[model samples]
Target: MSIRFAIVGCGRISERHAQHISNVGELVAVCDIVREKAEGLAEKYGAKAYTDLDEMLRYEKEVEVVAICSPNGLHAAQTIAALQAEKHVICEKPMAINPYDCGEMIKAAERANRRLFVVKQNRFNPPVAAVKELIDAGKLGQIYSVHLSCYWNRHNAYYANSWKGTKALDGGTLYTQFSHFIDLLYWMFGDVKEVTAYTANYHHQGIIEFEDTGVVNLRFYNGTLGSVHYTVNSYQKNMEGSLTIFGEKGTVKIGGQYLNELEYQQIEGIEIKDLPPGNPPNQYGNYVGSMSNHDHVYANLVQVLTNNGIIATNGFEGLKTVEIIDKIYTAAKPL
Candidate 1:
């Protein structure tokens, strides 16, 4: 039997969710403040449309899972409400803007006895999967340090007439632009023990409320040292999103425009080969970068819901992602 899904935000990301939901399950309803956007997606998928999420939740009794594709700041409230309505939730990344809200969302899920999954689709990238396996199996012995780079362009036009750059809605470059990279850092290493950072609005001064570029240093709980350099000031398009690790036994770099390529490796005796190509990056009007791995995400959701399988990204993991980002932003000082 197909899982029944409903969407609470019919934005660009919602299209990806709807497409994957249709493949793995049925899209029973869609909700958005903009009537046109809601109706547009609903009509395309043969699902009911609504301008209010609460009303949709109340009426769409068959919706087993609610995907929260709304703006960053609204994720916690929307997700908590859906969980209270006795439906599972699949929230987009960063989970929530702050750790407090993320904690509340987790509490709501526990109280309601519902599942809360966060979308960290980059984890499904074949190269990422391979590297994770290597690290887990101790190939990267005593992982000493790691470096992350996110050089992506988000022209002024991309933020115009949308909620992409605002502090209240978008929650800064890390939340909207590079949370996946941060999550990968945590997933591979462990919790961040310390953070020191500096940020600036080099190019997007009047456009975005927060920094457009930043540098960070992290000390993971497992004694791994990490550094991150990120920016939306890359010339005209996304330049690179990569992670390089150095350890006692091996060195590996996962580099590409996205984390889709296993660029370099010098393991002790293991070789990563025959990695199947991954899905193309998601495109929104003109900008592109969010890896299109929602199919894997939805598939995992189904496996966990129906087969008692392990959730690829659970609520606690989602909360940790936010907690790390919160620490980074809190440590950040203007450069």
Candidate 2:
């Protein structure tokens, strides 16, 4: 029997989650503040619809999993509610807007004896996976430094009258646009030990409450140094999202706009070749987000829930992502 699932937020990203859930599990319910959005996904997936998440959680007792695709700020409350109701949670990235909320979500899940999964789907990208394997195998040796670049264009219309640009809901550009990249940084290197950043609104001054562009320096717990350059003001479209690693033994770069391609690699007698093709980046009308790996995410969910397999990304890892972002934001200085 497939695991029964319910989705809380019926936004663009929710559609992707629902699609994957439908493939691996049964989408039993969908909820959104906008009844129309909830009803729309419900109609397509043959699921029930409700405006209130609690109502749906109460009514849909068959829902073994709750996928939280709501805004960054709403994630903690919604996830805790679902966990308290005895359901595992699969939260979209950044976990929560802040680390305290993330800790609370984990505590709730622990109290309820349920699982909490965070969407760090980008880690499943073939090039990313290959690099991780190499690093773990000491192919990269003692890492010295790294660079992360996120240049994506959100434009005015993308944020217009939506939660995309708000400080309360969106939780800054790192949370919404580049947290996955940040997650990659933490996953490969260890935790960030220090951060110094300068940020600016740049093009979206009157549009977004927080900075649209930032230059950040990081020192990892292992004493590895790094820099992150991110912006949503790229001309016309997303230009690139890349991570370059420099280490004692080798250098490798996972480049391309979505970090889908292994742009360069010169290991000490190792090369990444013949990687299985990965899913394309998620296209949301004019803009594109990270690589589409929700399918892998749901598959892992099923494996863990049904077969006692290992979880790809757990709640603690999720909390670390939020913690790192919190550190960066706290350390940011206006440009």
Candidate 3:
């Protein structure tokens, strides 16, 4: 039984979602507020195009999974609606702008008895996966500290004609651009017990509603401390999206434009071997972004629905990512 799919937003990321869904499932319909965008994707897949989500849900009863790529604020409501319509939902990152909305989404999934997934595809990166395995195998020993450095460029032109950089819909830089990095921090370091930080809108002050740069210090439940220094004010291009984990036994750093390369690995006695190359970066029309691993996410979704395998990044983990972001924002006020 193939998972039947529908896409709620036909933006840049939707192309990745549709491409992967076509491989693992059937694309029954696509919906967007813009008719042309919806029609374009629908025609490409030979599926129905809808301008309204409700209409798509009511008509496309065969759509078992809805992949939402809408704005941050709309994620929770749209997810709840899809779940109520008896469809599982795989939402694009951040889950929601705030934890409260994330909680509501989880509740709706529970009430509707449908699976809710969040796209944290970076977790599928080969190097990142390898590091996680090392930690799980107790090879990394007791973790001590983690550092995340995200220095990327988001210019005025990038946010010029876009809804990005808004408080209401797009949320801040942490939610918009660096959420995946923050997700990795939570995933690798563990639950944040405390955080203190500061933020600034150094470059795009007039353009974006929130910070273009920030620094945060975190203390985890396991006594591991972490720091995050992120910015979209890179001089000309994206400098790096890298994570360095220092532990009792080893210190490993995964660095590259998209965390695809294993920059450094040093352990006490064991050797890390034979890591396949990570996924290539996602190429949007105007800009290049994170690793392109939505295929793995879809593969997991297929196995979960058809073969009873567990969801790789389930709703709770997704909520935790959002929760951690909220804590950072609450602690990191503007300068």
Candidate 4:
């Protein structure tokens, strides 16, 4: 049976979701406040376009799934409404502005008895998958510390159009770009016990009230300490998502997306001797290096719905991520 999908908020990323739904499930409806955006996507996907979600839900009876691609602030309310309407939900990242909203979304899903999946598509990258496998295989040994460096460049104009630069709306870099690293951190090292963070809008001289640079220190529940250095200012414009894990027996470094390339050093038996570092400037050489084909996440969502498999990033996971972000934001605020 084909799942019928309706997408809310026809924006930049919604196109990717639409392509996936068209390929896998039946693209039944498209809804956006902007009529032209809805109509454009509706025509492309052969789905009805609506300006109001209630109208779409009432009229388009076949829409079993609703993808919440609206602004960051609207995600929780929209997701809860969709679940209440008896449609499963796939919410975009930074699940909500805060943990309370995320919890409300999860509650709505549970009450409605529908599945709620959060789009943490970065984890789907091939290199990241490979790193997970390596860690699971005990190649990294008893992991202790992790260093995540995400320094990308997002121009001031990027946040000029929408609710992006505002704290009440977009929630800043910790909510936007560095969120991938936050999710990655949780993926690698389970729960966080404590977090101390500092944030500032140092680089971009804009009216928007949010941070463009943030440094976070985390203490994991398992006694693993980690640091995340995130900034939106980079002169070279190179995107780097790298992780270096230090373990009791050995160390493993996976640089770039999907962690496709690896460098590992192991110290044999209780000698207490340090093994030489694997490589200088260990560049996984663009491991699995290339942009991901669009619709990758949507296709995966289809599989999850059809197979009744566990949602790798479910509503609970989304809420937890938001909780962590909230903690960081709180710590960063002035005392």
Better of 3 and 4 by lDDT: 3
lDDT per residue for candidate 1 within 218-329, as digits (tens), equals: 9999999999999999999999999999999999999998888899999998899999989999988778876799999999999999999899999899888888988999
* 10 residues in a row with least lDDT, candidate 3: 279-288
Native-to-model Cα distance after best TM-score fit, residue 136 in candidate 4, in Å: 2.9
What C-alpha lDDT, on a 0 to 100 scale, does residue 232 get in candidate 2?
91
Record all residue pairs in model 1 with backbone atoms less than 3 Å apart, i.e. clashing: none
lDDT (C-alpha, whole model) for all candidates: 0.93, 0.93, 0.90, 0.75
Candidate 4 Cα outliers beyond 4 Å, as residue runs: 257-296, 333-335
Q: Write model 3 residue lDDT over 85-125, tens digit each, in one string.
A: 99999999989998989889999999999999899989999
Candidate 2 on 95-167: residue-level lDDT in tens?
9999999999999999999999999989999999999998999888999999999988899999898988899
Question: Candidate 3: misplaced stretches above 4 Å?
Answer: none
Better of 1 and 3 by lDDT: 1
| Count of steric clashes across candidates, in order | 0, 0, 0, 6
Q: Kindly list the per-residue Cα lDDT of model 4 for residues 47-166, writing each as its tens digit.
A: 899999888888887788999988888898889889989998998778998999999999999999999988876676555665666667666677789988776766666666778788
Off by over 4 Å in 2: none
Candidate with the larger TM-score of 2 and 3 = 2
